[model samples]
Target: MRTVLVLTVSLLLFSCSPDTDDERIGISGDSFLIFGHFFGECIGEGCVETFKLTESQLLEDTIDDYSGQQLNFEVLSDALYQQVRDLPDFFPLELLNEKEAVIGCPDCADGGGLFIVYSKNGTQQSWRIDQSKGNVPVYLHDFIDQVNARIALINQ
Candidate 1:
């Protein structure tokens, strides 16, 4: 009986979910969200940067002269949004766990980056890659490259 009730509730929630075309929580349509921090070992000393991207806008915050400034852009196009939404599926959620134990260079400078994606219905997934360790995941690199390319195109 408990299992049946759980299934019934789950079905009701699914049925009540907004259409993929509806924009909610500032995310456009069924696109995903990206938000996280990229920091060096000295992050505690204002040496870190952060970014967030929804389907309709991109935001960046960086520490400059010990002051933080946030920049917002409305340049995320539909095509680019789709790419960002699909990028997270290639990563395993466990990638977000600290992997310092597997790092090959303990003496190397400690700087790593993490990116998170929140689906339309609020499911979350994230990945963290260490710069002082082995090769960072290629998919993350590709996603960053694509985002940069799109931003460049918009800037021009």
Candidate 2:
């Protein structure tokens, strides 16, 4: 009897979930929404680059990594991001520095996105780059290597 009641309730609840499209909280002030988890889809005008967000687990997986804080959309930061984007969980942040990090948003309004800040120890940085243009995420290790390579290329 209990099982039947549980099933009935579960069915009712799932049936009630809105059937338009699954929505994602966009980076800048919630104007854009991702309806699905597209492993290689390009968004925003600034980046024609495709994203592999399987690791961020933006869809689910509690215990946000970077900060080990309760995950919430409006308040998520690099602390939580480390968790959200941990390898195999999702994709790790795409940018890093010696003591800081800047997680990029591929697409944002007007080709201007934002950055999530973090320290070298992987703690979330209080400062964030909001709605910046030209800066973008491109996978952490690759981004760092390229930056160094660019300097070398210039020297040569």
Candidate 2 per-residue lDDT, tens place, 54-143, comes to 223233223322222333333334443343242221213322232433234422344322223333232333222313334533344443
Q: Give the candidate number with the greatest TM-score.
A: 1
Worst 10 residues of 2 by lDDT: 31-40
Taking every candidate in turn, the Cα RMSD to the unseen true structure, in Å, is: 10.7, 18.3
The residue-by-residue lDDT of candidate 1 on 10-73, one tens digit each, is 9999879666333223355655555443444563633443345655545444432212233343
Candidate 2, after superposition: displacement of residue 130 in Å? 7.6
* Candidate 1 segments exceeding 4 Å error: 1-27, 43-46, 61-108, 144-156
lDDT of each: 0.45, 0.31
Query: What's each prediction's TM-score?
Result: 0.38, 0.20
- Local error of candidate 1 at 63, Å? 10
What is the overall TM-score of model 1 with all chains considered together?
0.38
